[model samples]
Target: MRLKILLIAISLAAAVPASAQTSRFSPALLDRPDVKRALQSVDERATAIVDEWIHLVEIPAPSKKEQARAAYIRAEMQKLGLTDIRVDDMSNVSGVRKGSGGGPAVVFAAHMDTVFPEGTPIKVSREGDILRAPGVGDDTSNLMAVLEMFRALNRANIQTNGDLIFLASVQEELGLLGAKHWLETSGYKPDMFIAVDVGADDVWYGALRITQFKFFYTSPGAHTMESRGGPSPAKAVARGINALYNIPLPPIADGLGSFKLPVVNVGMLGGGTVFNAVPREAWFTVDLRSLDTPTQDRLTAAVTAAARNAANEEGVGFRVETQMGIDYTKAQPKQQRLDHPLVQTALAVANHFRKPGTPLIAPADVGSTDANIAVSMGIPAVAIGAVRERLPHRLEENADASSIVPGIKALISLAVALTTR
Candidate 1:
C-alpha cells in the first residue's frame, strides 16, 4: 500500500504543469544588451573589488564604533556618483540612485561592523587565493560586493523602474540594533530589503529570533579561607551555565512553519580574580534563539529563573539584563512565505549561477541579521552572502579570492531582477 501511495504521488508530481516551476532566468531581462555589458563590467572589475575588500576590512569597524569605516564607505559611495548620500545618527551610511520611479524601492545593505574589539590589528595578509584577516570574510567581502554592484549599475547605465538604495548599516554585530533603529525611525521604508551578508551558497528569507541576556551575580569579596559560608558569584554563574546548557533542544530542521522548541547556548562566561581572593562580581552572556515567540520567551524565562535560583541558594544577588535581542511580539507579518516573489527571484539568481545539477538555494534558515528588523516589520527582505569563507568571527578568518566574481555577479543579477519586477 505504501509503495502504491508513493507511486501515485510521483505520478501527480510528474503531471504538474511546467509553468509551476519558477524560471531561473528572465528572458526579457537577460536578452538586453546593456545587461550583458553590465555583467561583463562586473567581471572585469572583480579584481579591483577584492582590493577594496582588503582595504575596508583593515579599517576596524567594531560594533558601536564604526565611524571611521562608515566614513570610508560613505566616501566610496560618493566616488560612485551616487546621489542623496548620508549617514544616520547610528552611523548607518546610505545613498540613492534614482530609477524610473515606477517600481519598488530596493535596498541593498551590508553590515559595516565586526565582532572583533576596537584596536584589534586588522592588517590583511594574502596567500594565493585566500585573504586572511579579522573581519575580512564575515562581511567586508559582502560590503565590497555592494560597492561593485553600484559601480556596475552606474557604468552600465541600466535604468530600473524603482530607486536602488545602497546601505552600509552599523551595529549589526551588536544584535541588529542599527537595523532595528533605522527601520523604526527612518522616514523611508524600502519596498524590498536585501541584506548582503555571509556567502553565495544560499539566500535566507526568514530571520531568526534571538535574545541575549547578561547574567550578573554579585557577592561580598574575601580571601578563600574567609569566603566559606558566603555566597560565591562565580559558583552561582557556573550553576546557571550548567542548567541553561542542559535545557533540551528541539530537532534542528529547515522547515517553513512555526517553531516549537529552541536551541539555548551560553556564549560568554567569566567571573573571578586571583585564586586566593573571591571576586565580588561575575557575569556571563546567554544566546537564546527560536522561531516561535512563545518558545523563545519560555526558554528565556526558564534560564533567567535558573540563574535567580542559583543566586538565592548561594546567598548572592542575581540579575539578568537584556543585552541585545528582538522582541518577537513586535514583529509584523512574522513569517514570510517561502514563495514570495522576492524570495523566488533570489532563488532564480541562485539557480542561474548554481552549478548544474546542484540543489537550488537552501530552505530559509533562522538567523539573527539586519534583515530581521525589516522582516519583522512585514517588509519583503532577504539576506545573501557574497564570498566563500572558512572561519568567521575568528582571528584566522579568510575568504577565497575566487568567490568574488560570482558573488558580485549574483548581487547585480538579483538587484536588476527585483528592480525590473
Candidate 2:
C-alpha cells in the first residue's frame, strides 16, 4: 500500500504543469501604470539609492549590536508613513503598509547585521559600476534595496489587496536569532515571508540543517616543566579537532554553488593564556551543515562523540554546548513547499528581472538566511537576492553599483505581485 501511495504521488506530481505553479505572477503586472511609475522612480533616484546604500554600509552593525542601523531603518519606516512601526527589544524593526484587506499578509525581511566586528573599517569605495566595502554586498545592499523598494511603492501611491510588512531583522549573522525571536513572539503571523538576503540571480526555497557546537576541554593548570605527562586541555582540543575532521562525512549534495555540503568545519580555537604553562581550559567551535535531517542528526551525534572520546583519551574534562540548533519539526514536506505559490511567485518575478544573457534563475533547496526561521515554522517563504554581490563576509566584499537599480524595481514588482494576488 505504501508503494502504491508513493507511485500515485509521483504520478500526481508529474501531471502538474510547471506553468500552473507559477501562474500567480505575470509580466503584465509590471505593465500597470502604478508599477511603471514605481519602476521609473527607481531609475530617477538611482544615484541617491547607491549613495544611501554606501552610507548604510559604512555604519557598523555587528551581530547583537545593530542599534545604529535599527534607528536609521525605524526613522525611514516612519518617513514611509507605514503603520504599526516598531523596533523590538532585539533591535528588529518592522512596519506595516496596510492594504485593502482580504488578501494574504506578507513580510519582506532583510538583515541589518554583518559578520565584521565593530572596529572594522566599513567605508565604501567606488570604481565605476563597482562598490567595495566590508559589508557592501552581504545584506547591506539588500537592506538599502528593500528600503528603496518601499519608498518607490509610496512614490507611486501603489496600493494592493494585502498588507506588506517590512522587517529589518537584526543578528541574522548569529544564526538567525533576531528573526526567530520576532517570528515566535510577535503578535502578527504573516501568510508569506520573503527574505531579501541573497544575490538577485538566485532563489532559495528550502532551509538547510545547520548546527553549531562549542566544545570545551578542561584540566588543572601547570608549569611547562610540570606539565609533562599531565593531561593538557590544549592537547585535548587538538585531538578532538582532529577526530572531528576524521569522522566520515556523507556525500556532498549537488547544485549548491561553491558550497561543499555535509561538511564539518572547525571555525575557531583558543587555549592557553601563557606559553610557559598548560592552560586550565581550551575550547573550539564546530559549524556543521547538511541538506537533510538524517544526515545532520548522524553527523551531530558523531561530532559530540568524537569530542568526548578525545577528552577521555587525553584524561581531560569535557563539556559541550550548542550555540545554534534550529528545530525543523514543523517544516512542511519538500514537494508541498516547492509547489507553494510563495516560492513559485518569487522565482518567476526574480527571473523576470534578471540581467539579460544571464542564465535562468533556478531555486535551490538550501538556505542560510533569516528565511530559515520562517521555513521551520511551516510558513510559506522564499529567499531571493537584491544585487549581484561577491566575497560575502569578507573585507573585499563588493557589488555592482548599477545592478541595484533593476533590483529595486524587481522588489517593487514582487511586493505588488504577492500582495495583490
Candidate 3:
C-alpha cells in the first residue's frame, strides 16, 4: 500500500511543468510594485540620461585631474538632495541616502576619470541610435547611470532598509588610487559595494590581481665610438623586456571554481634620443595580472629579478619603481568568492534582466576595477556598468542607447535587493 502511494505521487509530480517551480528571489524582486515603478521611471528618463552622458564626457576628467567632473557631479548630487556630500583630496565625490529602516550600508560608485588625456575632444556624434565620442562608453555611460538611479529613486520615492551611498570616484584610470585613498580615509564602512564600470549587462565579481612595475635604467652617456666599453641602458631595457615576455605562464584552470591563467605585458618603453649616442636613461613599464594573489606575487618577483639581472649584465643603474611614482607599487586585491551573497545577487539580478538562454556575466570574466579596494579589505563588492559598450579606451567608444534603461533598472533592483537583505 505504501509503495503504491509513493509511485502514484511520483507519477503525479512528473506531470508538473518546469514553469510551475518557485521563482528565484532575484526575478521575484521585479514583481514588486515599487520595483516596477522604478524600472518604468528609468525607462522614461533614458534619453535624459544619455544627454547627461554627453555633457559629462565633454568635461575633461583625466586621471588625477578630475576636479571639473567632480564639481559637476557634486552639484548634481546636491540637486538630487543627497546628504553629507563631500569631495576628498583625491577628488572622490560622494553622497549618502539615509534609509528608514536600519540595515546594512551599501555603496554604488562609478569612476569619473577617463583613460583619455586632457584636451581629448569629447564631442558626441549621433549616427542612428548610436552615440560616439572619446570616453563615451568606457565609463561615461556608467557615471550617468548612477546619477539617473539616484534621480529615479527620489522621483519614485522608494525607501530602502539600508543607507545608500552614491559616489563618483576619481583616479580610477591611474591604478585605482582614488578608491584606495578614499577607502583608507573615509570612516564609513559599507556592508556591500557595487562599482559601476565597463558594461551594464556584464558583471564582474572577481577582481583580478595586478602589479605594475616601472624599470628605469641609467648610465653615463657617450657617443657610439666612446661608449664601446660603457654600459648601455637601452640594451638593458630590451633584455628585461625580452625576459619578461618569455617567462612561462601556467595554464588556466578549467575547474568549476578555478580562474584563468596570468598575463604579463610591457605596455610602454622609452629610451634614447639620438641614434648615434648611447642613451643615459631608459625606462619600461610592465603590467602583470593574475586571478590568484600568490601567483601574482610570484610572477611579480620573477619579473623584478629578471629586470635586475638584465641591468647587472649591462652595468647600468636599474631601479625597481612604481608606475605612478608612489612610495610603494600597488597590487590588486583578492577576488570575491562566487558564492558570496553580493556576487550571487549581482549575477542573479543580471540574468533576470537578460533574455532567456542569454548569459550576462560569469565569475571567470574578472578584471581590475575600483571594487578591488573593497574586496581586498574583506568587503563584499562587485563591478558592473550601465550598458554594453564597444571600443573601450578608444576614440570610437560607444554604447547601445536601448540597453541604458534595462541597465539602470538592473542597478536599482540590485541596490534595493541588497539593501533589503
Candidate 4:
C-alpha cells in the first residue's frame, strides 16, 4: 500500500504542467521574526556597507587578474562562518551556508572583475545619494550587497531547509569564463541559480545569443611612397568595418530599455607598428547579439562574409577568430524557462522590495550575465540586481548609495523565501 501511494504521488506531480507550479515566495515571509531581524541588521549597518563598497571598488580587479578582490571575498566568507570556502584557479570564490535539509540548493553569484584595466583610476566619489567610480556600480556594488546579505543572515541566525551558496566569480567581463568554469568543475549542482549582477529595477530571465569575433586583415609590407598603390590591411579593415555595419538587422526587440537588439558593434581595433608603412596586419573585434538563435546565426554569417569580402576586394589575406562563442543546444525551451518557479519567485520577491513609485518590474527576455552560463546548462536561473547602478563599463559608473539598504533586505528576503520553501 505504501508503494502504491508513492507511485500515485509521483504520477500526480508529473501530470501538472511546469507553468502551473507557481513560485512559493510571499511578502509575509518578511514579517517572520528571524527575517525581520535580518532586515533590521541591514538597516543598522547601511553606513558600513557603503564604506566597504567604496573600498572594494578601489581594488584593481581587471579580468583574469582578480587575486586581490578574491582574497578579500574569501576572508569575508570565512568571517561569516560559511563552510567549504574555496578559491578556484580562476580566482572564483565560493562558500556554502549549510541548511537543515529537505529543500533545494540555491546559488547566489556575483562577478568580481570589472571592465577597467589595472591602471584605471577607481577612487569612488560620493555626492549625496550617488557614488561614482570606474567599477563602483557594475558588479562591485552587487558583490558588496551579496556579502551583506550573507552577514545579515548570520546576524539573525536565519536557517532554511536548503543550502545557500555564495559565489564571487571572476573574468565575467571577458565572457563569463569564471562562471562557466565553476559550474562545470564544481562538484555541487545547484537546484536554482541567481546572478545578482544587474540593477535593482531590472530582472532578466532569458539569455541573449551573443557571439564575438576578431577579424584580421593581412598584406605584404609597403613603404610610405608605395603604400597608395599596394594592398593595405588598414584599408581592408576600414572597408570590412563599414561593410559589417551595412548588414541589415532585424527590427529591435521590445522591452529592452536603451539596448537596441540584433545589433553588431566593433568594440576594439588596432594593428600597426608605424603609420608610414602599409600595415602587415590589422584586426578588429565584432560583438554581435540577438534575441534568438536564427537571427544570431544569420547575422554572424553576414558579418564574416562582409569581412571576407573586404579582404578580397582589397587583395589582402584575411582570417577570423572567435573570441566568445556560446552553445545554446542544451538550453531549456523558452516557455519552460519563463514559466519556471525560480524566475517567478525572483520576480515576486524583487517587486515586493522594490523602491516605491518605480514602475512595476517585469522580467526581460535578455541577458549577458554569468547567469547565462546556467541558462545554457538547462539549470533554472534568473539575473537580478542589488542596486540601481548606471553607466557600467565607463569611467563615470555610479550607483545610488542609499539604495543598498533595501537591496540587502531584498536579498535576505529572497534567500529565505526560496530556500525555506
Candidate 5:
C-alpha cells in the first residue's frame, strides 16, 4: 500500500489542485541552469544561515519540551514570508511554498527536540573555527538547515510544480511522535517526505532501518524467602533476558543493511519491599531493536514465550506489554536509495565540502532518529549532520565554525535541488 501525508487547518492563499501544482521527477532529476545558479547562490549566502543556525541550536528542546523550538521555527518560516504557516497540536511546525504548476507535496523536515535535558547549556563557544555545544550537530544544525533551505529556494526564485512543506517537528526523540502525527493526520497529503538530520557530511548517506521496542514482563510476586521454588517475577524477567540474548539475530552477511539484536537493556524494575517480605508486583522495561521486522518480531515472541513459560512453571501470573515501536520497518515512500535524485542532489551539493562514507554509515547508527519514522511510513528520508563529530551527547559536544558554512552550503544546495523540479 502507498503512504499519504495529511495537512490540516491553515489559511491558504488559495487551494491549488494537487495535480495542477505538483511534479514528480522519477528515474532522476534533470539538472537545470537554475539549479546550478541556486547552488552557487547558496554558497554565497552561507554566513546569514550559519549565524541563524547557532542561535537556534542554543535553545534546548528536549523531547516533549519542544514548544520553544517549534515557536522559533514558526517565526523563521513566517519571517521568510512562507504562506500558511501552522503549528499543530502535537507541536509540528510547517510552512508552505506556493507553486504555480501541478505538483506533489514534498515534505521538508527537521526535528525540534534533542536528547539533552531541558535547560542544558546550549551556549555555543568558538575555539578557533569550531562551534561547541550540547545539541550543536545532532539536530540543531538540521533545524537551521530546513529554515535556510526555504530561504534559498525563495531567494533563487526557484519554483517547483510541487508544494514544499517545511516542518520543525517535535517528539522525534520519543518514537518519532511528531513526524508520525503529521504522517498519520494532517490536511496535506505528501508524495514524499524529506527529513534533514545529523549532518554527517558524505562519510555516509544512508540511514538505518530499525524497529525499536520495549518488552515488559509481569507476574505475581512471591516471598523470596517462602516461595523459593516458584517463579519470582524477577527470575522470569531473567529468563526473558536470556531469551533475548539467545534470540536469533540477523547475520552481518544478510546485505539487507546492518542489524542490532535486541539490545535487551532492562531500563526499570519494581517489586518487593524491605524487611523480608514477598512482594506481589514486578515489572521491567526491555529494549529490543533490529533492521528487520521479522528479526524483531521473532525476538519479541521469544522473550514473551520465555516469560510465559517461566511464569507457568513457577505458578504465577505473567504478561507482556509493548511500550512502543515503529508500525513498519523501512521508511515510507520507499525508493530512498543513495542514487535517488534527492540523495544524488544532496551528494552533489555536499561535494563542495565532504562525502559521507563507511564510518558515518557505521553499523552502530540504526535509525535512532526521525528519519527512521519517515522511512517506516514509506517516505524517502535521510539524516545528515554538520561540523563532524566528537563528544556528541556529552557535555563536551562541539562542531567547527569554519566547517559550519560548508554544512550550510550543503543543505542549501540540496534543498534547492530537491525543490527546483
Candidate 6:
C-alpha cells in the first residue's frame, strides 16, 4: 500500500514517460488477459443475475420500507465477498471492496425502494428485448448491474488504489431520504459519488442541479354567495404560474449568477370544503431547478417573490412552504467545476467505448435525482447510463439487452481509470 501511494504521488506530481493512462483510464483493451477471461466467464452468468434481480424486484419495497429488499441485498453482497456490509439507519445497504493504496473512496449507489406501494405486482417477464415492470429500469436493473460489475471485477482480480463502495439506498422516490441519511451516517466520505438510478446508456456530465419551490395563495374562505373577498391562493398560484410561464428559460444556464431564468410548475393545489365556499386557505407546489447556484438562488427568490406579491395584492394570506428535510438541501454544499480528474477519466472511457467525438450531453433536466444530492453535498459527481436506451421510467422502460455489454465495459473502464491513478 505504501509503495502504491508513493507511486501515485510521483505520477501525479510529474508526467508519465508519455506512457499508459493510469490503470483507471487505460484504453478499452483489458490490461490483464485474466481480467478479460473473467469478464468472459460472466457471459454465462448474465441470465442468472438478471433472474435474481427480477426475483428481488418482485419483493415489494415502497419508499421507506426497504428492509426486505435491503436484507436480500446484504446477503447477496456477503455472497459476493464484500466486507463490512450492512443496512444503515435509513435502510441503505452498503458493502465495500477495499483497495491497496491511500487513494480516494468512490461510491456507486442505487435506491432499493420503488415508487410503487407494497403489494404492487412486480413480476418480471421478457417483453422481447425489454424488461417490463414498475421499477425494473428506474432502479432494479442498475442494482443488478452493480452486482454484475462487482462480480466481474472480482473474477478478474482487478485491484484498485481507491476503495469502492456499493450502496442500495432507500426512499429515492420519497425525496432521497435514504441518501440523505447515508451521507449523514457513513463513516467514509467518497471522492467520487455515482448515482446509478437513471435510464438510457447516456449521461449528464459535469452538471450539478438543485430544486427549490413556491407557494400559491387563495383568499380567506367565505360563502361564495356572500363572502367572496380576498385573492384566492389558487388564483395567486395561477398568477405566479403565469409569471413563470412568461419568463423564458434559457437553453443553457448562465454560469455565474445567483439566479437563472425561472422554469416553474404548479404541481398541486387544494384547500376547500365545498363548491359554495371560497377556500380560506389554498396551497400549491411550485418546482424550480437550475444548474448553477446563482441561477437556482435567483429563481427561488423569484418564485417566493411572486407568491408573496400575488397574495398581498389579492388580500389573501400568501405563504410559501419550501421542501424541508434532507432532499431539499445538502448537509453541505459542493463545489462547481468540470475538471475533476475522475470526471475527465469517465469522459475518456465514454468516448473510447462510444462513437468517436460524440460530445458528452450536459443537458439539464427539470426532474430531481439522487445525483443532485451527491453534487450539492460536496461530492464531485456525474450521472450516466450504463445500459443506454430510450423510454426509461415510462411504462415501457427497458435497457437494450445487447448494450448491456458495452455499458459494462464503459463502467469497468471508468472505474479502472479513476481508481488506478
Write the residue-wise lDDT of candidate 5 on 1-421 in tens digits: 1222223222232364221232223223324655555556666867766677788887778889888888878887888898888888898998888766565576777788888887778888877767788888767776776676677666767777767888888888776789888777777777656666654443223344333333334455555577666556666556655655665555543432323343445655666565454455555666666555666677667766665676666555666666555666444332234435555444444544574443323212345566566566565555555556566568787776556555655665555446544
Q: For each candidate, what is the lDDT? A: 0.79, 0.92, 0.79, 0.92, 0.62, 0.66
Residue lDDT tens for model 6, 1-421: 9999999999886774211332246654565675576567567676776677678768888888888888888998998899999877787999998889877888878788877767766777676666667777777777777767777888788888888888889988767778777877787788888777664334443333445454746564677678655456656666666766666565654432223433576666666777887777767677665555566666766667766777776677766567732333432323232445655565556656664454543323322556667666667776655655445445555555555565666666666666765
lDDT of 6: 0.66
Positional deviation of residue 373's Cα in model 5 after best superposition, in angstroms: 4.0
TM-scores, in order shown? 0.90, 0.96, 0.88, 0.95, 0.75, 0.80
How well is each residue in 1-421 modelled by candidate 2, as lDDT tens digits? 9999999999998898664656478999988999999999999999999999999998889999999999999999999999999999899999999999978999999999999998998989999999999989989999999999999999999989999999999999999999999999889899999999999988898998999999999988899999899999999999999999999987778888778998899999998799899999999999999987889999999999999999999999999999778889999988788878888888888889899999887778989999999999999888998899999998999999999998998889888888885
**Candidate 4 global TM-score:** 0.95
Candidate 2 C-alpha RMSD relative to the actual structure: 3.1
Stretches of candidate 2 exceeding 4 Å from the true structure: 1-16
Q: What is the lDDT of residue 79 in candidate 4?
A: 99
Off by over 4 Å in 1: 1-28, 254-261, 330-336, 355-359
What would the TM-score be for candidate 2 when compared with the true structure?
A: 0.96
Off by over 4 Å in 5: 1-51, 102-104, 119-122, 202-231, 253-280, 310-316, 329-339, 355-368, 390-396
Estimate the Cα RMSD of every predicted model relative to the unseen true structure: 4.5, 3.1, 5.3, 4.6, 9.9, 6.7
For model 4, residues 1-421, the per-residue Cα lDDT tens digits are: 9999999999999898443477667777888999999999899988989999999999999999999999999999999999999999888999999999999999999999999988998899999999999989889999999999999999999999999999999999999999999999998899989999999988899899999999999988789998767788998999999999899999888999888998999999999899788889999999999988889999999999999999999999999998778888899988888888888888887888799999889888999999999999989999999899899999988999999999888888889888895
Q: Which stretches of candidate 6 lie over 4 Å from their true place?
A: 1-23, 28-31, 117-121, 214-220, 227-231, 251-262, 324-336, 355-368
TM-score of 6: 0.80
Candidate 4: what lDDT? 0.92
Model 4 alpha-carbon drift over 4 Å, by segment: 1-21
Which candidate number would show the highest TM-score if scored against the true structure? 2
Scored against the true structure, residue 357 in model 6 reaches a CA lDDT of: 57
Segments of candidate 3 deviating more than 4 angstroms = 1-25, 253-260, 323-336, 355-357
Residue 262 C-alpha lDDT in model 1:
64
